[model samples]
Target: MATEITTAPHDGSTDPASPARLCGRLLGRVETRLHDFLAAERELRTRVDARAAAPIDALTALIDSGGKRIRPAFCVAGYLAAGGDPASEDIVAAASALEMLHTCALIHDDVIDASPRRRGLPTVHARHSAEHARNGWEGEPRRYGESVAILAGDLALIYADQMMSEASPSLGAAWAELRSELIIGQFMDVVVAAEFSADVALSRWIAVVKSGRYTIHRPLLIGATLAGRPELEGAFEAYGDALGEAFQLRDDLMDAFGDSDATGKPVGLDIEQHKMTLLMGLAMDRDRRTREFVLGAERDPAEVRRLLDETGVRMDVEAHIDRLVEKGRAAIDAAPLDERWQRELGAMAHQVAYRNS
Candidate 1:
């Protein structure tokens, strides 16, 4: 039987005691903590020199722009599902730290990809570059902008580490591993894109390390570790591995065929940049024409889209995502969680797999 998943609408419940409401409340608190922490940091920087806070402003703008907040959501959900105390502020700080870390990643990634926009607005580098150009800055506008963005990303990383400093000592190893994996995975992504290899195995490895483990697995485990339920690591690992692939597949599908308005970013960027995403890797494997087009010096996004549809690679990936989702759900189901948490995690799997943005 196909598993059914439904998202509950917000009922405006104020009772944090309710299990159904606890996760939602905690998520709200996480948002508040981020806003408050950033505000305080901004204020302190402004006191030193108003101009010195430009990087902080850049970070704040990106956070305010809007995101799915997937990492923090997973972290908090993992902690709560593992029966952590609802009243503990530890989870809030950890979750906020995850978000700050994500901000760092996005800022640096934009610089690396030379992406013009993010979340429906000009990216930090793009905005700063334009400002430099308008102001007739001393150095090249592009270089100046990228330099500022790098500094901003570095600052965000520092802030993330500061926030995580107060977390349980048990989190030290996990935190270090997660940060290193992110950096290494990002380097691998850049290398693969430049090489433009069609190696499915390498592509899959990059996806798992970069998107899968970093976004879902580590966050969940961090939450579980904080809750003193490290045993849940095995189940969360299985679940994260499966669902993370599904999440990346969905991302590829959206980048390939989704509307820019809905996605809040340009489409077909991976193809343009020659990034060997899992979808493109699968397409190359399934169709000779796709393989040739991708490897050829001149690439056409329209042609690739047609090949994906005509070759049924898109449909195949959709089916594959369904199977991965089921695999994730099974892992969560087998874990020794209460019925409510089991259901919550199951719903989360579906949400992550099927998200449009």
Candidate 2:
């Protein structure tokens, strides 16, 4: 018999059939599956050559460091809500794959953004660069570190594909679409940041495609697909899209006003990079000084934050988040899922929209 995985800590609810309880159990399985898979891969590479395992070590370290695990949570919630079997290992594999892909994105994104930290630790590229510098290793330290980070990210992407391959063949199309969309969305984000056009429409499109759909919508759809419940697609899409925008907006707010200690990453990165965030776009549209701050050559994140608050853009965005949370709840309420799942999903929407990190 297989060893049973433990669920997340409960709220004193002894009922095992509770939707939250079941989803927590599934998420636990996903966590275990990820650890086991990476451990085995590390062991396999170590036997061949100790140095060969360095990238695996980096991948393992990042996974262990800590993340929100939002994608996997949404995936599991979608599966359970769609009535997937609690015992099915397929969902576990799929959820694990989603997390691996997210890990891959993070590694690569840090390189692109030149972010020095993640989860309160030196980012993969930053750490490796320092290692290269300290050791006086080959070529440019930055180049060497970036190269290693890229390779590690590639390894993660490959591992994600391998894990997803264990799932049913029916998921091939959706999986392909998800992967491609992530790449395309990232590409668009990079391009828009370089342009810094202050186009609200463009910014909104990037937000929806890069953060909203990628973070929430696709994961939910993948879960529904894995549960063999294609009928839930429409409702899930609506919920995911609305909640996803709210999620991204909250992220923007956190970057602007949240504590670095709590977020485990540098705040105001969006402003520093001059990336046309949805919040920034709204601020520019609503206030002249905010627009001047963004368009000016000497942009200061602190000044932009002050401008946002002064112009009431922050309050407006908060109101928008509330509306989106409600919209997400209504979508699930109209779905054919059981009331328990609807409530659980609604709770999730609120959590995502209001998260501080």
Candidate 3:
């Protein structure tokens, strides 16, 4: 998922090596690498298969769109925390690759969501679908659009793998694991939604495997592996697991009630899609209204939202998020990171949980 961070100047010195400067500064490298790589790839695709440049353009445009750079930042943070050279080509390439993989996921996700808008603009599929319509294509606009988007996502995954291939072999295993988890998570998500399964354990497992492991935990491990710091593995997982849970919990909340402009997604999507979440699982166990509301949300979302409000699951979820964030904080406190990363990651945790998008 993409995020938008709000920055404030640090109180201390304006030293070049300060943690205060690292967060947004490292993102500059990521953006530059992404731009340069995509430009080269665009030229290469144009020469080899000119028509293929369209999807590449879509991917590049999406990257150019605004983002908080959370995943790449986490990779950099882990590398720095492990004393890896941030200026080294390996780390920069790996970090950029993480963002590419994220792009791939979002493309596929937008296809799954059939979402029209992302980051306040047309999603890759929607953009292509509109183009198909404008061209007076001879087939269904949506099918043509979605098929192109799948190819774009596949191409993105290929580019991500190509970018990270330059990194150390140790990083390769984590990369494979991450891709596998992503596929499995998507599969599980579909099953849960299709069946409307309220099994609490299944819901939690989906959260852990999908968002928790894929987003935060593996990235942390990937960073540490790049630095050759195997000792930090347990600590990385601990910190990542909690933060990842908080991240998804917040995502679900945003899907339920956030402004379309603020979230870059339609409000009440979870209800509209009937996606299973832990909050839904808990609410189901407590009363019948939650189930009724979820079932009715597709037809009359406002009433379902009202029913949801009366059920009080929203407040319960808020408290649960607080608890998970605290666990993440405690893990960070006990981790073998330096003072600089300790402060940086602590601040990052709050950003992950409390972010508006």
Candidate 4:
């Protein structure tokens, strides 16, 4: 929403639709499709009783907040780029399934991060906690809030699986692999975060499993598998790996500096929570004084800013961002891709590094 109008330059030969623009177009397509799917599934809302309304309400808020819907677009794009028909049932099924998977992840991520807001609105736990407090019927607000959020996240996971299962038979294998990767990746993320054993190597491992694979790679792979392309496998994998890291690194940057309106979460959540991000870990290892400053800083926003300024964490973080961009570019170059696909992938890589939201 920054009115700087940072549109990518294009010419007639580029079809007036750069890869980033095409990503937005494809995301719009999937968003409409998902809205229809949710409308059809709204019957589940009516089925739940009043006693369980909290979870339903939380889920509804999440659905309303929505997102970029990029994962499904990635799935569909990979499918079509590999010669799969857009109208094919398998393609639609995979795209829809990927969206559901993403939705499930968001619900769980909000809970794990203990985020009070998303999209400038109260997060599920925050909303439920407020409701509980108003009713004056709770023992502890935090306990009740967390419990409801946990159940809400569970319901989202169940619904995601249900959506995938109801898809066409041809997409079963793709769906299975995606779900498996998601679960494994999520578990790995939780373990790594909890243990605080995240160095650059561990961060890279978690990045591929937790963010890279599910967010980009697996979805693309599923789409390509649906298209029955044996040759494009390596390219798709490489694209996902690079794109996924780019996405996560961008997210880390956003957690540090993005506007609340743009990113839909409080800035500095990563610093406050002491999340083990690659940027922080790399900075810590590169400069002992920077590490000491970050460790010594208070959780207040002003103090955190001062620490970053005084110890050069911000500069170090910016350097790591540049490194990630370079790595992404190299991976895209190494992929077995033609001019059109390479251009698309390059645009995506750039977008990932430069994205504000």
- The number of clashing residue pairs in each candidate reads 0, 0, 0, 0
lDDT of 1 by residue, 302-334 (tens): 898998999999999999999999999999999
Candidate 3, lDDT over the whole model: 0.80
Model 2 RMSD in angstroms: 3.2
| Candidate of highest TM-score | 2
Candidates in order, TM-scores: namely: 0.95, 0.96, 0.94, 0.82
Query: Least accurate stretch of 10 residues (summed lDDT) in model 4?
Result: 1-10
- Candidate 2 has a TM-score of 0.96
Model 3, position 123: C-alpha lDDT score? 92
Ranking by TM-score: 2, 1, 3, 4
* Candidate with the larger lDDT of 1 and 2: 1
lDDT by residue for model 3 (1-357), tens = 464331332445576776646645666777889999999989987986789799899899899887776778778777778887757778888888988999999999999988898888899999989999999989999999999899998898998998899877778788998899889878998898899877887887778777777777887788888888967878878888888888888887788778888877687877777778766777776668767656552546566566557888778878888998889878878988897778777877888888887
Residue-by-residue lDDT tens digits, candidate 2, 115-142:
9999888999999999999999869999
As for lDDT, the candidate ahead, 2 or 4, is: 2
Question: Residue-wise lDDT of candidate 4 within 1-357, one digit each (tens)?
Answer: 221111333333445444445444455555566666665556556566546456655665666675655667667656655666645655665666676666667767877888898877887777778878999973988778877877877776776666556655566666677678777767766676666553777777667766777777777777777777646667666667766776777787677767888887798887777777765666567677556655664436456556565677667666666776667657657765455655655555565567787
Where in model 4 is the C-alpha error above 4 Å? 1-29, 44-57, 166-181, 191-195, 295-313, 316-323, 326-338
Error of 2 at 300 (Å): 1.6
Residue pairs with colliding backbones in model 1 are none
Of 1 and 2, the candidate ahead on TM-score is: 2
